[model samples]
Target: MKPALESSPGNPLAHLPFYYLDNFHRVLDWIGDRYADLLDGEEQAFLAGFPALPQPSRALFVRMVMRKGQLFRASKLQYDEIGCPRAAAAPLADAGWVVADPAVTLDELFDLLQKPEICRAFALPAGLKAARKDAQLEALRAAHDGARPFSGWFDGDAAYRIVAKPLCDRLRLIFFGNYHQDWTEFVLSDLGVYRFEKVEFADAARGFRTRRDIDEYLQLHACRERFGNGEHPADVLHDVPPPGTDNEWLKSRRDKLLFQLGQQFEKLRDWAGAHAVYRECGYPGARARAIRVLEKDERYGPAWELLQHALREPESEAERQHLLRMAPRLARHLGHPRTAAGRLAPPRRLDLALPQPDGDWWVEGVVRDHLCRDDAPVFYVENALINSLFGLLCWDAVFAAIPGAFFHPFHHGPADLHSADFHRRRADRFAACLAQLDDGSYVDTIRHNLVAKYGISSPFVYWNALDEDLLELALHCIPPAHLKHAFLRILQDVKANRAGFPDLIQFWPAERRYAMIEVKGPGDRLQDNQLRWIDYCARHDMPVTVCYLQWTQQ
Candidate 1:
């Protein structure tokens, strides 16, 4: 039979024999099927109309046609006809050097296309010829370099194929065959187009052998004996290596890997693993930071242990302070309130003298009686009665004892009194006294005294005569007005809505029925609206009280 391209003049494979065409048809069919989707209507029609070529030219034609088709399809145009071998084939055939085949399979064509000697028969460009020779030389070099007893036939045969097995072996050695396992498998397996039977089988076996060798090496060299038979393979793999090694490259690689692993662990909320990696890096700050992250997630035990370990390491005073602050909060969160309290050092003691009520009996004596005694009359007599009487008798003496200590002027000296310094001092003393009281009795006594004595008759008089400074100071020192307002608003809403006010609100003296309470100092007369509000409240059965203290009290 004549070569397939003998009818065409410039055919590159015009010199090859007919027997080589057996394998070329397989590659043509594969190209047609593989690129069917990408081909345009015109190209598909043209390809469909074209018949398979004959002989060695057929195999060569498949490769050249596929490559040109791919380039044309990619560039969306026809390519230059640099060396038109098909056109030259007729002349070569005339010289009785060419042959052709009538029928062939796509697989057979693929095999023939892969044979290096057959490929060289094509009328290739000078650059391509040089490249092909260089590739062959390199393949030979690789085969010689990687020549092992078992790999001899495989490597030598691959050197003659399109892809060299020896070069693949060298690559495996250089990269340890650890990187891109899937990619290497793809290139060496049935999935690859360069499928020389011997090379394919050899690569498959090599892959299996390499995997087994790796497993065996790990089992033999790694501390596998330390891991009981019950341990998981993954756990053994992870714990096998020591944190750091003398190999600087390995150590650096490990550090990077560990850091990346720690980040992933943190994302997974694997606090234990994250902390372990951080600890391995020997970065106390990072470890502490990881512990903090774990703590936020309520991984208490692990975070606590990590923190303890970090604390034991050499750390700055700032770090200690941070730990000190965090310990109490964490302890409280962990349901150890007492431990939290223990972490707080004792508060420094103040040097100010305690307020004495009257007749050498300190205010504490009256406050204590009020709290301890059940007798209402006795309680009033000791806590409220003595102070009320003493306040009315020698107001200065009582005011002097507790400066800025009363809630209102009514609780201290007279209000018509205009001495700012006296009121200021009395306000201060009253504040100090209330500070000592530290209970609800003081508020109750003041409210009860006002109601019992003044009877809400003139809310302005009760509020005006009250030590506003002392009242304000006392209130501030106690629960504070904003908190008091919140509590009162809630109580009022509850009462108004019939929700039932809390018992605590009833205990608050500020909630008592007063027409109007003016918050001002002594000698500070009521404003017109204040008087109007007082009048309005009186008419509406809402009593008013004024709460303020003189500036001198400060």
Candidate 2:
């Protein structure tokens, strides 16, 4: 005898016989009642028939009903459309049941439906199934050039219907050649979703078509071949000319290509080759243009040569000015300034001078005073030496004028007094001066001093210092004028003696054989000669320092 049903609803069908007819009937009824809203009319009828059916038939019938409902929903159609009268009365009768909750708003759930297990369970209609199968076969045929006997099976009305539908363009392309004029025309004409129709066909037939008509057309019209042979059919016309006369665009493209080639040659450091190409283009302003490009590339030698040739020709004033401007830069590149040795006799003796605390006190005052009293201009005669000494001495004094200044002198020995001690001591003094003076008053004082002393209308002071570790750093800070002066000194020394100077006198420690240093106050930078000297010292294993002044908060 069967046991009485339990009151608990743990599992309503648990107590039912595992394979008994009565048990299967109860299970089916439980399912229908629990998911009444989910069941279609046919599924409900099948469940209701469970109690009367034989044990063997009940399980199979329930499975068939559930499977049919799933198939009806997945096909995006109602059971009525597929000839199932009972399923036609379901809750999802119009739109069909969404296997996963159709109303579920989460992206995760939507993604879950795309999984193989879920997608497999969701059955499509027979017609869609056949069409999808045909698409897969078409893709395979396009991918592999094999001639299978079953190929003809897809050739009739079924093939056209499947291919004609707005399916994936990639799949469609496999069915059509890249240059299929009809497909190309269709894709290009569409201003909407079907715009990719040709692209899809091209992508599918890419690499398969050997002798594409599109390529032939481009070749015949002197148009650049845009697509590679194995490229997709959709991509064939990607860079093709529009459907009209082609010379203008083609010519423009050619010119652009040549221009780009010239740029590429310039990039490769082939300035000559690039210049030649630019000349070949016959641009009216090609000569000046080529020279500019060469100059930018630091092809100074070639640029200078070209400029000389241009100057020899009878050019307009504008052209002459252009050449003149270029001349100075080229002159610099070629080290054109005639040195003292080249233009003037060497001095009787070289003088080493010490920096004085007072701006008016010259290092060798007696000698300077005597020369100043003479009819000759001593200032002009010793201008180079005076400038050098003044730069060294004023570095610290100028730095001290700035508040919170501290000097980091890059040198092998003790920090230069010009930068080190002066920077530390003068900073507070300068700040005090600045604090006492109003902004306008300070400006007026600077202006008056500039005009009275330097004979300049404007006076602005900027200084910086460099430490040994930061030599490269300090060199960058020096003004171009100062740098030029320093380089001139180095050049002067080199011209005087071919082996290079014994050591940069300004930075060299009197006691050490291989020590070099340069000191600058706040805002000051190393001169060019100083930089060259530092490089020379560095190459020769001499210890070097470039010290800069920094302002420390008191």
Candidate 3:
């Protein structure tokens, strides 16, 4: 007889069977009832015939199916660890599902768990550890059939071969509420190629028939492989039909794939392969990639030629910047060819002084004092003030809705922005939530989030000293027209732009004016993301400046 379900309604595991095999039948019955409409004709037929068999026969089938592997020690199903009566697995032996093997022993279980090297570590009887491994296994099997606590031991163990693995996996999922992650690891390991690593476009080319299919496939496989993986993309260009498939979306992906291929080749020091890949990439940065590869290989002639070609039609700011930076170095190698454009001058450094025995906080105070006084606008060298302010202001809309944003289990930040579909998936939810609120709501929400959720211990509220003044000033500085867009941009790429705001913000409540100042101390430089933010702010007519600081002898 099967183990009875508990009577209590409150227990989550109340309805579960005590025996693993009986639970398997329960899962099948449940799935058949719930998902019969969704299953195909073949699946429906299998479910229709499952229940009529005797209890032992049904239990045997379910156990083999749910257990993942076909083999098991017969005793596992028959008796509990403390010698309790469970289902007799005799029906499995009577049928072909389980084949008896007298040779099977505890040593086989050790091997199955991949612990054969530490077999002696197990607390077997005193002499067992010293005996030969084969002798120990044989002795243990004999002891099992003899009158020990391990009762009902047959001459040998029973083994199972899963004839229908996929069906069994579905049964396990329905019964246990999870597929066995370890049971089918070897069979399912290949999913890693399609999952946590980028699939070569060539490998996926045949599988993807439509343009959108290719795009989605590439997105799912965006996890880049480590450097020096000896794998190359198949020439997917010819495989993907370019004739009728003039879709711009497909073309764009093809271009991107080629560019990534070029980058991989460049990293591997395959200069010629990289150059070939880049030539066909058609991306703005492709020429730079090829040029870098050539330059690394000390092939200045080819590198200079590529640079000149790229200069004629520089596509993006990044391309232009690279050309400008590399031009002089490459020119030196090419015997300093004379051109109408004059030699590039070295960058000029600003002359400034710090107070004697400079600390970062001291410099911040000096700059703040230098910039502000009893004036219309208040100047604050607020290091983390703006970021903290934003964090507080956007707390309810962005952080509250997302679990683990503030209350993470391991105290780590949310998943990587570029990695996974994290930012892309959450961006819309974040944007829509943030857009619904007005200026007053932002202020009130910040206060609520600070006092209620974060309280006194919140890192974001550490600069609560300036919170009221900063909030009032920010109300003036943040443009009403672009508030949603600005906040959305910040949330959309939060991982990249969250922590890197400018150091100083001068606000004039009377004039309704403000300017962001990126204070660069001696040897400090603007990062790429900072430059991007500055450009973004400039385009929106938000006042921002980069201040270069230099120390002089006082």
Leading candidate by TM-score: 3
Model 3 misses residue 40 by how many Å?
14
> What is the per-residue lDDT of model 2 for residues 1-554, given as tens digits with 9 covering 90 to 100?
11222222453444443323333344344444334444445555544543553333333322223222222222332222134323322322222222222222222222223333222333444443445443433433443453322213221111001111111122122222222322222212221212110111122112222223223333422322332233332343234433333322223333433444455566667776677656654222346657867887788888888888987972332344456667777778777873221111111123323233436643333333433322222221112332332233232233332221211111111112222133244445444434323332433443343333231111111112212222322222323334333333332332221222222222112221222234444465554334444554454444545534333444
Q: Write model 3 residue lDDT over 168-269, tens digit each, in one string.
A: 554433323222232222112222211111112221112223434433433323322211254554343324333234333334445666777777777667
lDDT of 1: 0.35
**TM-score pick, better of 2 and 3:** 3
Which pairs clash (backbone N, Cα, C closer than 3 Å) in model 3?
70-160, 71-160, 102-156
Better by TM-score, candidate 3 or 1: 3
- If ranked by lDDT, best first, what sequence of candidates would result? 3, 1, 2
- The number of clashing residue pairs in model 2 is 36
Each model's Cα RMSD: 36.5, 30.2, 12.7
Task: Select the stronger candidate by lDDT from 2 and 3.
Answer: 3
Model 1, position 354, has a per-residue lDDT of: 27
* Global fold similarity of model 3 (TM-score): 0.43
| Cα-based lDDT for every prediction | 0.35, 0.35, 0.51
